[model samples]
Target: MKFKAQLHNNTVLYRIAQSLAKLGKTAVVQLSQEFIKFIYLGESEASFQLFAPIYMKNIFVDYNIQSAHDNTIYMEFQVDNLIKVLKSAQGNETIAVRLLRKQKKPYLTFKISGYSRSGRTVLIVQDIPVRVLTPVQMSHIREPVVPQAQVNILLPPINNLRSVAERIKSVGQCITISASNTGKIKFHVASEIVDIEVFYRDLINPILPNTKEFESDQIYQNHLERYFSCTISTKNFVKFLYAHYIVPASISCVLIENHAIIFTVYVTTTAIGAHFEDQGNACGALTYYIPAFAL
Candidate 1:
């Protein structure tokens, strides 16, 4: 009368186990994606009776409890095997019934021995839901919101610095890059950084008008960014690039705002006095153009 289910990945299965030790009648159970049907007959002949199927198909009649503590029956049907049998023999009752009764295939073996009033019975089942994991492999997820005015972007590499830079450049935007003190590098984007973030959100969380469901990562990388730009304070920008890109701490201060983002990186061999190298470590600036469109 009572059931519990276990789910892993896309597969799910449920079982109704017996609690009382005294009852020993064999239980018969049938299950499908939509429902589970159980039967508890007083005799083997009654279990195989003509009305068994009809009673099962509409068995949610009335019950004080889904399963009485000491009077409930349980069934475990082999889900896959049952589906195969049912689908292949939709109208072939003789073969289906024979297989159900004779074959010892791995299946939902019903264990139906419950004590109930002479004319009273119980049945219980529920629908199980399944969810598929999104198959997205994108590295960055975008956030919504954009600014109306121009925004400056200062980016330092966290990992794979060059690869990240290359991806951004591929957006066909012009980017100005330069070496700075220690081992830091910087990039600048001209568009409002907020707008870029909004674009990224759309790319990462695409909406489908038809199904009203988010699109699966399986479809395609609809809008991967070839480039990005961020604005950072000079000091933090140095740390950001160093920590993320694995660049040394000596590099600092990239000037990254104009018509394009520019970096005047002062690469230094030593941490000390690196920020104040020859004439205050003012390296030549590198400029890159920002792309007009989002990936």
Candidate 2:
């Protein structure tokens, strides 16, 4: 087995690791000729899941992966350490990630190269130990599936939403998120003595393409005025906000009404434009599935 890839976008690589570090210390990585996946396969006791796959064509100028095991390699490594090393990378540096065997142990190494202030070339190598996962170990892991979203709306800047959500977290245990196909969304919190709500109007309510799985009444096209609301743990919701550090070009939410909220955080720039429905998913997206809080 052999794997070595050069990542030109250091910022994206750093952001991906930072977000995963929020939930746990380690994460699973899958590498193939097509794309490299950075996954956070939520804990058994929790329902949060993250799937971040970056195609080599988009982010890597140099890509190589050769494995007798179906041309793919799966490994798990410490995300906390990965983020700490990535933090040292500067804007001008290129990170070459590779899988290495040292002293009979597996390791994921990041060799960063760039020029220093004195015009001399600088090299920094960060070796992160990893455990190569076998086929059986990763067999059952998969992305979550839910019913077609009832309302799909583009979110405001995550920094703004995160700030508000963090404050609300101090006074509430759960937050009720309500949305409609009419370009409106509301975040409401209530207690025995307080009821507070933050509302946004005239937001972009993207027209979701008709899917065969969507029922006649559940489709947003026909129910523009209907609202779908779900209450989710305030803590978990705030944790999801940390992804804003990646500086997403845009963030969109698919509300399944009382079921789950799937956020599509676009890592690529200009994800959705004039032809939003056509171009919204043209590039890779970081998929986050946060289950609704059960009463």
* Candidate 1 RMSD computed on C-alpha atoms after optimal superposition onto the true structure: 27.9
The runs of at least 3 residues in candidate 2 whose Cα sits more than 4 Å from the true structure, single-residue gaps closed, are: 91-94, 208-222, 269-283
State in Å the error of residue 196, model 1: 6.1
Tens-digit lDDT track for model 1 on 1-295? Answer: 3332321101111111111001223334433223333333223221111101112222221212233433223343323443333233222212211112224332222222222456444322222121111213111211112233122222332344444544454342444443221233344434445211111111111111233233764322221212323333222222223222213222223232222222222222221112223424421111111212212
Looking at model 1, residue 62 earns an lDDT score of 23
Model 1 regions lying over 4 Å from their true place: 1-155, 158-160, 175-257, 270-295
TM-score of each: 0.18, 0.87
Best by the lDDT measure: 2
- Over 27-121, each residue of candidate 2 has an lDDT whose tens digit, in order, gives 99888888778888666624788888776666666788898888899999898878877788756567898889999999988898889889999
In candidate 2 the C-alpha lDDT for residue 51 amounts to 86
